[model samples]
Target: MCSSCVMLFNEKNGSILPEYTDLPTLQKGEILVKNKYTTLCGSDLHTFTGRRKEPSPIVLGHEIVGEILELAQNEPFYDLNGNILKAGDLITWTIFAATESDEFVKDKMPQKSASLFKYGHVQFTEKEKFNGGLGTHCVLKRGTGILKVPLSVDEKFAPIINCAGATAMAAHRLIDEIENKNVLILGAGVLGLIASAIAKQKKAATVTILDIDDTRLENSKSFGADNVYNSLNPIEELTAITSKFYKKGFDIVIDMSGSVEAIKTGLKFSATGAQHIWIGAVTPTENIEINPEVMIRKLLSIKGMHNYNYEDFINAVNFFEDHFTDYPFGTFIEKEFPLQETEKAFQYAIKHKPYRVLITI
Candidate 1:
């Protein structure tokens, strides 16, 4: 594991340059995975733009699917039986930090964070704790494996399930609890499109998508949006549009773009006893005032969904496999670039005009 590894780093702001790096030595009970495909998450944008920072000279990327390249011996990676573990099996994880104790997994929240933060490179040495999917391979320490990706699924799409797809699936799962729900989602990005697909698959009475661009709205329809509206005024546009489709306000509202004004106005269009799920990770400094009385009077329910759990990941994968066309065909769009082009990939992902921009290393 001491051999040189290649990774992207932010030595300067707003740019990423590939640097030859040393592969991290395996810790006890840890396994080194040669990352195959990693997706640049929206959170990676925050870090790139200096909106967020970890320890300097760190690798960036979290959502990844990889193959185990090597395993620690002496204390073999398998169970009591001497099973020889080999590489090439596709796997996906929540990418949590490795913990020596079992107590972390016992606590749900800690376990979740640990799973998501495994690629953190707190220090820039061979102990690359902040390392993530932007490299040739990533180290997945023990106690963090979520599920192995089935060989039947496309490896390219695996990363999406962990982040964007999970957000969509989580929102849909929450709405599935209600009866004959009508979903109105803002923003026709990949998350919004995936959410609309799931909502329709769950037999939502109506799934209406709102976005300013007619192209995105058309894409939303292809992803099972029952109707599409190109409008900026959420309250007026949603009320009018949804009324024409369901003759009532939307039974649920999902804000994927994290616009405060959009959220506030969308709140008014939610039907009585409706559920509103917030999946977008808005900046912490942004603040919005909501009328508690209006929420109470309307019997509205609002929930916040972060990263999806193991079950949600499985659901998204299954959804893609079973209903690929029903969902947006180009959800995983753009192109695949080798590891060296990571900086270019990040810029392309942040720009508009595609459902998802993926890079394969």
Candidate 2:
């Protein structure tokens, strides 16, 4: 069988070439999936705009949802919940696959394992042309963490569960608990909004979000953000607002903006014994200085998460399935394009800067 796909020939040219390749025979423990919907994530935009570089002729999309097309013979495949997988089931998988022997797995950072194979970032070859979300099909390799999405979950929203949603779950995991805590999320993007909702659901005392975009901050209110601030405002104004609600400072601060200024301001808002989780600094940027004396006096704990682990993915799926109706997850994707218009989709996403842009296969 042949599958259609769009490949990035060069980052310098920013051209996406459409191509078709013969699907390879499924290996043991591998499953073929028909791409249903794929969303253009922030990292994908970075690569397309040459802000980040990836190998040429690579398929670049990781936030994806698909349906099982075929299952390898003689080997039983199971999802993260241990349920047996079969053809026709809707599913999504971890962005990277790691082996048990991976040293990072022992260190509890499987996403950075030595043998990690990340989907959507690999250079396309004849044998693995369908390994990314921009293609009509994808082959779930061995050791990949798979999840069977429920029929009730919208196809458009499911694609993000494995990426942004899972990363938010991982950030919260680092905080350990949220009940009765004042939580402040930096950035009102998808990750920050999702984090706000999760904090409220976990019984946080207050949930606040900060973003430069007023529109996005308004949207945050519907997603469980009790207070929203435009960080672009004057520093004194922001400080006054924070003083009004966060009298004792926030007990938990999560940075999803990757902005040095935002992180610096967030650090100042940290209450004594606060926990800070940074998930959005995946790219190179200017560093922000921190005072060791302040950290020592406040007893702040800071941690960073990259991609997510299997457990985080599972929690993300469950959270979406349980609370899909509670929030407007559908509104995130402002526009959609077909596989043939994948390039246009990226262009629209870049120009409009919508929360997400979808490519349906």
Candidate 3:
């Protein structure tokens, strides 16, 4: 029997106090993983500051890497490589744990469908309390797509694969291909930075990023952004500067900032037969007006993506395996906080605007 466990409980008013709960007994189709690293993402910040509504007193976090603690016997479960999973293996799973088969899952878009049981976005009940990466141990229920991580991938950089890396990979699917295309990215956050690097690796001719944070913009340089611009400038000035690369607009536009103004300005620069991907508006904000005529004239296609599917997660792991050693991916983790100091870590990340503040379990 498992004993009492500790987790960084989200108290909303900027507190991640350590809370204790009894661990649930493992059952068929259930697996338990000891937490290694849990990422504090932009969504966590929104929930921390009360901008996003969530169940109070819940354990909050989803981006995670953990070691297999226990697994159900006789359960038909396979890792990404079709290898049978066993205890002591390092692994991560998709954020969405589908409760039932549905059309969406059949269509390969399980991120937001089919009786979702989202890690870190759920409230704990008496039956089973821990549900997120902030916990000492997290439950990976049935239907979760578990993937094995090779020893080559550092634990620090692997957690973001569930969120940042896969999300970018999903967004990249918006365009037919990235090679030789001129790409524009808005926001120098984790997703934008990774997508930029991935696009560059795919041979994008010119990769430009627009963001207000100079520090983050500078950080994008190492990640594959060919050019960085301050979006704080007037829309026309931003347009003119971006236009110098391609007079009309880029072949592909990716918006990770979710700013209405930025979207409006970015739309103007998309070339004929272009693809625009919107991913960063994870939170609802003020809506902006746009001219549909541009879509009509340029034959532009806009795609909006949320959390990624399982295949993207697998691809993310491959991307890390190929590039983790070469790029400064691990450097994004600026500081680490113990499980109990999650509140402090969130505050530090907010104040310093570091690439990411991690919860090291």
Top lDDT prediction, candidate number: 2
1 or 3, greater by TM-score: 3
lDDT of 2 at 263: 92
lDDT of 3 by residue, 1-361 (tens): 1244656555645556667676778889899899889988888888887778888778888999999988887776788679888899999888878754777778888887757788888887776577888878988988788898767888887889998899999998767988888899988888888998899889998899989988888889998888888877666765665566654678899998888777776787788888889988877788766678867988888899998888898888888889887678888888998877777888898898787888888
lDDT of 1 by residue, 47-124 (tens): 777777666677777778878887776665541122344566667666454353545445533335543444643435
Report lDDT (Cα) of residue 26, candidate 2. Answer: 86
Better lDDT candidate (1, 2): 2
Best-to-worst ranking by lDDT = 2, 3, 1
Residue 192 accuracy (lDDT) in model 1: 88
- Residues 1-361, model 2: lDDT tens digits: 1255555455667789778666778888788899999999999999998888887778999988999999999878888899999988988899988887778877768899899889899888766677789888888888889998867788888899989999999999999678988899999999999999899889998898988999999989999998887877876765665576545688899999999888998898888888999988989999888899999999998999898888899999999889989999889888989888888898899899999998888
lDDT over C-alpha atoms for residue 186 of model 3: 87
TM-score of each: 0.86, 0.96, 0.94
- Return the TM-score for candidate 2, rounded to 2 decimals: 0.96
- Clash count list over all predictions: 10, 0, 1
Span of 10 residues, lowest total lDDT, candidate 3: 1-10
